[model samples]
Target: MPHSPDDFAPYAHTSLPRLLTTAHLLSGAPGDHREPTELVRRTLVRVCARWRRIPRDDVDFYVRRFLVKEYLRGSRGRARRAKAQRAVLVLLHWEGLREAEIAQLLGWSAGAVRSRARRGLAVHGDDAEHLRGLFAKAATGLVPLDVQLDAVEQRGRALRRRRRGAVAAVCALLLVPGIVFGGNRFMTGGSTDGSGGGAADVAQSPTRIVAPGERVDAVPGAQVWLTTDGKHWSTPEAPNQFLGLTDASAEDTYRNKYQDKYKDGYGSGRKVSVESGKPTVSVQPDPLNNTSYFLSGLYRGLSADPARVEVTVDDHRITGTVLTLAGSPGWGVWYARAPLSPEELKASSVDGGPTVTVYDAAGKAVARGGAAE
Candidate 1:
């Protein structure tokens, strides 16, 4: 039986913003307008098709799981850490889900959830609350409700038509003698990955942008690859390393709204500096690769010439990769994976984190900040 458009409109109207926000965070590109909207639209179309059949108490959970699966589908080429970090962060912070619930949703053990959540929170403390505020502020200018509802209806209708056509084709084939269809092998929407949503498809890669007539030089034996656009990149070792990029805008907006919040000595422990073209640094553990941590941040407001960013992890200095996109995106992405042992991670938890320094082409240190203990 088919569900009516009227039946789903009310729920969609109320839930769309949060759903959109979740999708934005999970997609690892909150600043990119199209990816988040497209993700929510696809997930909602799926929900609208089966709205009546879903249990009322479980609708929110079901929709979140569905949205996660949809994100994983297109994220086949991403590294395991990239995928796991996003899932754990959004579920723990944004959705207010516990470790056990997130375990069931992602097919991981409760211990795994606890371990990752603890490590993630160690670095991204209070980020979710600030991010939610910025997203809510941005949602004030979204399109009218009727237009959004109509779009969902049209997509739902198209989906049903295709499903009916597939059924008819299957039935027509069934008429042949001695023919049998087995398992979900004949099903059109079966999981592309063999793990049944536990992993991603091996055939597809994350979407990369390459401008025509532009020459791109490949970095020899590089673990990370950046597109010519500079706005996007891929980390094969820990795909979720890039997830930190999603929080950039939210952090910036929060600083603007509370420009004088930390000027007094009351909250001296936390460092909140306004953007004055100086480099910022964020370091967090890679859940999938336990021995390594991701170090990344924006390098805007620096000299237009090539700049060198370096990080001193307990006196071991490493040169970082800095990406400045074409058309002057104001800020560019800079990152490096610092090797850390269990002993070091434990010690760093007590001491401060790494020290990051940015130097221009002239070898002069321009900006410096870190989790100074």
Candidate 2:
């Protein structure tokens, strides 16, 4: 049988006060209170539509739980709603709602609600006490009740305004450094290679060398490639050398060339050690060719310069002149030759093998040659 209007009227009227009170408590202040009320009204309307299925005992529980869950989930705006909900919870606690009932009303576990309530009380209880004290003092004086209430409301509004201003100031302070750093990077055209070009371009270009101990910015769109010769190379065009590419044979050739160059000691088995802080080096080992090559380095800050790197192996020191060219940052392709003599290899503690070092744009060492031991 269809329910008559009178049959639903009592439930609707009785539910109104509960919903309004809940909304008001959640709303924080007059300026923020209306929205919570509207939200509560809508939620209740939806719950009521399903009233037939909900047991009479559970209807209030369900509606209250829904409001609490919505507030916790922060469906509206977290920052604003969270503050309002905290204010509301404070009022509810003061009204003598037990921790368990508050939990049910807020759609949180009872323990969680109790913990949060305790913390909230610790933070706001003093203010509430002060307000109550002010009201009590006013009540005992000649001021009218309405006038006392008005003064309390004004004080609360002022406090909230001051708190909001402090929060805004803190947010600005935290964001200023990020804004400056980002703006400087953006204005300088994104690459800090010291040459004012993209970091990837500087890395890939045969002509470009990252100076030692200099910072270079990363290129947002740069692609890096590796050759078995211990050189970090970059290219705008996709080099056929990447994994699963069509130029597998070309990559094999490049790998073979490095292996052959290092097969017998070429530069008295000399090895170069490179490291860096700003640009990071990536390598891929070609199992078939027994070689690994440079992939890419993301450059940043003073670590962008390549010339600051030091390269040395055994007794053969990498003179500063050679270091200047060989350690230039960005990407470099280096070849490590086998020991010139067994004695030379033994002296360097290498087993007839070679080593390579990669340096960042800032001349800070970033990577070392593959372990041969």
Global lDDT of each model?
0.54, 0.39
lDDT against true structure, model 2 = 0.39
- Candidates' TM-scores? 0.41, 0.30
Instruction: Kindly list the per-residue Cα lDDT of model 1 for residues 104-220, writing each as its tens digit.
Output: 556455667878777766665647576556545555555432227788878877887788899999888875542354433344343322223321211111122233111122121
Candidate 2: how many backbone clashes? 46
Query: How far in Å is the alpha carbon of 303 misplaced in model 1?
Result: 66
As for candidate 1, its clashing pairs are 82-239, 82-240
* lDDT digits (tens) for residues 1-373 of candidate 2: 2233233346655665555554545554434545665566555544444444444434555566555555545555667545544744543553446664554344334456656655655665646565445333432322111112233334434555676799999999988986976675555553323245434322322233433211111132222222212222322332223221122243334445455443443223222222333333222222212222222211222333344222234544221111112433344433222223434433444432333344444434555433241
Measure candidate 2: CA RMSD: 23.7
Which residues of candidate 2, in runs, are more than 4 Å off? Answer: 1-7, 31-33, 73-95, 105-107, 126-373
